[model samples]
Target: MVAFLDEGGMVDFTIEYELTPDEVGRALHRGLKLQLRAVRLAVPTILAVSGITCLLVDAIGLGVGMLAGAVLFPFVLAWSARRLAKRQLTYLCVPTTLRFTDDGYEYRTDQSATTMRWPLFGRVVSTPEFWLLFVGKQCSAFLPRRAFTSEQQAELDGFFAARQKAGAL
Candidate 1:
């Protein structure tokens, strides 16, 4: 197990996790959703329908514009997502050693290591399968639920809750 010193200079706990591609995909998808929360995702659907209506009415210019908007941007996002994932795949598709303390957390992979205090994460979100840590809209950490025992998850929940209650998270 990995170990990191807490504020009290005590080694706290560790969780070893190996990330899978499907989990990475879910993480990326959730990260994208967080980033795009303010964006009008419905634009594509609306534009597609509008484009069809415009074509039906013989408004070629508007139809093409709407269709183009509906078609191109999502493809761009998809392409970018694919490209980004490919670039980061090597780093992600490895074993990870997560060391943590009451003060912060240390994320370690063979490619890189990062340490961040709890306050650095502006948001913490939980899905059925993951714990997502965010700094602004960017996803900073992906903690798979499968990695933790139920007791560990509960401990983390309490830890997070305490931080949140203290307005430190």
Candidate 2:
């Protein structure tokens, strides 16, 4: 998968990348499980904290209610947001192909293919939503979980581990 920009920031190439069904299925399962866990953990904590705060604060019982509501609202919204984000991240429909070559990996997006060597990546991180390959503090690649399989996920883990070993990302 190579996604790049020209001097003018115009997209050069983009495509619906491919991945095996098994890989996509595994990634989706993992992403779903993680998001569910997050929702469960957050919901109880929000309720517990708010309940305590409301009981302890005589002047701001309303504040506690509002705080809890605010948190819970997002949890509700996250149900859909997580679903969409997971689909994009996991590449369930179309996986972005990334080729690891000597110069670095090439990733093709909808409009362009960009190449970045390992040395250019300053850090790498993963969440239930994305596999982030950072170029620096402000620049990065956001690969969705929906776009990869279990094997690919393992491959990415190894890639990042190698980067850490080399003191790159």
lDDT of 1 by residue, 92-131 (tens): 8899888778889888988899898988988788787888
Cα-based lDDT at residue 2, candidate 2: 38
lDDT of 2 by residue, 1-169 (tens): 3344457643233334565555444444444444456665676677667767776776377657756775676567556645655565443345455655434667764645677877887776676656656655533455555555655566667767876888966
* Candidate 1 residue-wise lDDT at 145: 76
Those runs of model 1 whose alpha carbons end farther than 4 Å from true positions after fitting are 1-11, 40-59, 71-79
How high is the CA lDDT of each candidate model?
0.79, 0.58
Please give each candidate's TM-score: 0.77, 0.45
What residue pairs are clashing in model 1? none
Worst 10 residues of 1 by lDDT: 2-11
